[model samples]
Target chain A: MIKGGFAGRILHVNLSEQRTWTEPVDDALARDYVGGLGICIKLASDLIPRGVEPLSPESVFVLGVGPLVGTDLPSSSRMYAVARLPASGTVGWCGAGGYTFGAQLKYAGYDHIIVSGMADKPVYINIEDARVDIRDAGAMWGLGIDDTCESVYRDLDAQAGVIAIGQAGENKSAIAMAFVDRISTLGRGGFGAVMGAKNLKAIVVQGSGGITVSDRKRFNKLSRSLLNSFREYKYLKEWQELGMLKAFPMVPIDVYKRMKERRTACVSCPVGCKEVVRIPDGPFAGLVKHTSSALNLFTPMMYGMQDPWEAVKLITDLDSYGMDMFEFFGLMGMARELAGSGVISLTPEEPEIDLTSFSSMSAWAERIARRQGTGDLLADGFSAVLEKLGNEAKQHAPALIKGIHPYAGPGAALPWDRFGTMELGQVLDPRGPHVGSGGSPTYFAIRPLEVFPKHLKRMGIPENVVDRILGPDRNKLHVGRLLRYSHAWFAMLGSLGICARGQVNRFYNADLCAKAYEAATGIPTSTDDLRKRVDRVWTTFRELNIREGLDASKEALPDQWFRESGFKEYLTGEPLSKKQAEEMKKEYFDEWGWEG
Target chain B: MKYEITYIQENCSGCLRCQLACSRAYARSFQPSAACIKIESRGAEYRIIFTKDCVECGFCADNCLFGALTKTPKEVTA
Candidate 1:
């Protein structure tokens, strides 16, 4: 039996054979790798062979939570879902937090769940305590995420947490995500398509069991002490009200506030950063939906539609169809660019539709989800969209990192508006063109001198290292060194089931996290110990990518970001030449112990 | 005098931390379903309903980050 915080069980479900089995997690594995993303990555490396198709039955999907998840640690409710990304075919990892799923799984006497093989027909997995059932999802198939969740809840427990995909996954859209309780999602990596390939509709978990911590008193004391910091967070009220939207600052707050009906939070989160709005009495009356995200909200606004209600509608439609907002936004921008250059006279299948309007974008998004006509081409991903649109569209096509869309590459913004560390991390991420992989938060763009120490402290870097970086000329501080810390820090958090929100990091550091871990799991861990474990996990991740023949040689930012004109480095306001950019990448790779 | 955890519904962010805290205090485990205080959401609003299981312990209010839940001395006991 597993002691400490772990339930000691690894539930392996094979849909292809419709069999389920439980094995005791090797204590050595937990001791060495920690839990969640760490264990998931280690398992994925061993279970999945090289050159295996991501969507094939041979590919694996691993869901795990850390030892802290079921404890009272703040923001401990998280699940790391990982797979061979169908979008980029690289090692993809998504850390998601919700109110119930991870905790419920832990309470159900499980440390992790590994699913492999494909089901013969549409189905969903139901887990209640020790009982596991692969139920038919024929009736619920093709339903939107919300409806599917509601229907599944009706058939099961209302309290059961549902991680279901919309039609986007059923159709296997590469950009589709696995939506968690209509609140948060496994960020990227085409995990939804992986589920669709398995014919798995949803995973419902409900547990009435208990989680035992090694030292409850110490755990409670440590957790309770952190509450003050969370409450006193400078942006607490703002985050509670605006969440991520506050970080990006899009459409005046008054605009969203008018439609803002209420704010909600994930499981065990002190910062309720999610907002739900209802358009009270308009042509679109009683339309209730949650905001997509900061960058996602920017998509509708880019088309000259500023109405918060309209944006909410577009976001909901995108979610219902299981469309990726970034990819959709990129496609819309490319289409407009193609049309603007007089390359193609844009004519809609429905001639009455204003092809440039937000509604038209929504129409195209829906078509992409359903894979109908023009949506069929666009749904195949950005490269496919460009190919069918011909050479003009290809020229206008935004540079994609690897095969997937870049969230915010250097080309996406003017140099001043862009972040150097973040952009560099984007290309370096094994997942390719993703932000969350590097472990830095979106709020890292704050005034450097003021936030540097705090950022360093949060990552638990030694004061000596901080002095080394910020010494002499703060302008020439090597950002590559900081990126190395970020990679390790994020890898550690992923293994620990910790949420990656800015405030969470601000309130807790590696020292406090070690205490929490030690108290929860009787595993004596210190900052140094955890740091070593992080290095191991990160090295293993890099090794996995290398084994797949995905290395730094293939990494490159868009040409626009490297262009010298109208560009300046974000930190020093100095011109960022192409040679300097190449040198920076080399420095980053060297920090990771990689050779050019 | 009797005191019970009192909730300001509007201040609740629906984080459910109070429920986790309460469950820990009562059940000695992290179980939200067994907690005395329940946070229900409708649109953007959340309602905190205290159940009979509540022992008048202020753990939930004490852990509430937004002061959404609080306990003060009341002269009359229910």
Candidate 2:
């Protein structure tokens, strides 16, 4: 038996030197941050150079698979990769789902792998317990993500799993994503672009052996209850049914409603509503493609043109090139608006983004992807795109919150039943609500408010956990308190190496978490410990952001949200003004114990 | 008696609980591609087609409340 949960080692692969070494998986680090979060924090402090210029040789890529992964724990199959994000200028992360790497690392007797120092030429890493190699990827270069993974996995002389990027990453598009198992990806924040910049193609893994628990009887006893709890939860059922595809209807209604089909989701998800449609397959023929809710614009445009192929081709190309789809694509909408006024502004606050010319979805995406004419300005992200359009363009691009564009719209106008505000937790953060790791705007939702609070009290958070995060009156903007708690929860999820997206946490909530830990770690860590660990990870990332360019000023939400959302009390139209937002930020900063 | 857990594409969310469970139950490892229960994914479309060659394993169905995994009403285990 493995005993007390852990593979307990991290492998260091120096691509430049073409060597591999082992490092211990620090237990304290595991307790504080777990795999995904820990990899970034540890690598930032250990591997990366503050100003090495991310695309250069100094940048490092660290991929981690959590300890609970590949275990019988619910949804513990996800693995995370971390590097300095080229687009966001901070910690870059891409996580994928599978047992490939997680099992390999365990078999190899390691917890994670960090690849630093770029190779002199393109190469792929092949790993198996007691075996490692740096193989030339010259033949695999320039291929699409799907083809490349197929090629490499087919050629790799072992039972293998491959993680690769496509021509988009090779092109160094910051929006590019890393492709694992050909389908699922670490889709956000341009991790793929960083990989592309590194001139590396893929990492293939295979291993033998399995992690044994301290006590099989106790583990089985706890897991049965955990599984039963998962089967019993309503949220588990909802996620299993809906998945992330829930973001469809938000596309311009006239455009989306026509071509709508049944929605689906990624591996093992419940919210499978992400729609797929076949439009008689013409120019867009055989174009079996799916877009996230944030990219719902494609379906509608596909409908208008009666050509789903063209729309799919355009955005899928964007994803391949490692472009920040949400921010990059949203910028295109803003640019089309700017072209009409022949006006530009550095900041997008005063004048609303009037994207009248964005009427033609075809031209908007094509131009942005190819960086043609107005599209060139959008190749970076919204902040960069606005700069390219000039100060006048800035005024029109006012929808950004902490430079992270709105992934979705307001509650009433939301595409799905739950607008994800409760899950997204940015109702009050200055970086515009989505920047929050947890602490969602669920305070605005119904029913959940009651149950969630009871759970929090059970977890031992202060009675005011909800009211402080989303409460009116704002006695002391308790953003810090909530941030700490949510961060801890996320940390615990990572530490225990479980997936909160499904049943384990929902049915058992804190109860399941405590037991899962005791079952796995043989350590009786409480729910509060999990939350604190998550907070440590979150706070460290927040600090990383602060080091990058975040300050109290940047933390304030944009004026346009209050304007566009026109958020009003149940009876009053009184907007949560910019001044009020500033007050909230200050209070948050003060409570967080930041000097700002 | 045994029951099979067949993952239906329409209801899966890419959560990989089945695989995680399978890895532990059968493999004692957390590898999905290695698990007896597999999650077939369509990321952009957000669909999962879960398949298990195992003959009627009640464990998966017992845990799948989403209707994503069906017990195959007529399915008989031996």
The numbered model that scores best in lDDT is: 1
Cα lDDT tens digits, model 2, A129-215, are 667888898998878766776586565544456678776566565556777655456646567767777778887876655666666
Best candidate according to DockQ: 1
Q: Which residue pairs in candidate 1 collide?
A: A98-A267, A99-A267, A262-B44
DockQ of each: 0.59, 0.32
Reference interface contacts recovered per candidate: 0.62, 0.43
Measured by TM-score, how close is model 2 to the native structure? 0.77
Error of 2 at A288 (Å): 2.7
lDDT of 1 by residue, A160-216 (tens): 777888888888887788888766677475788888889999998887777878888
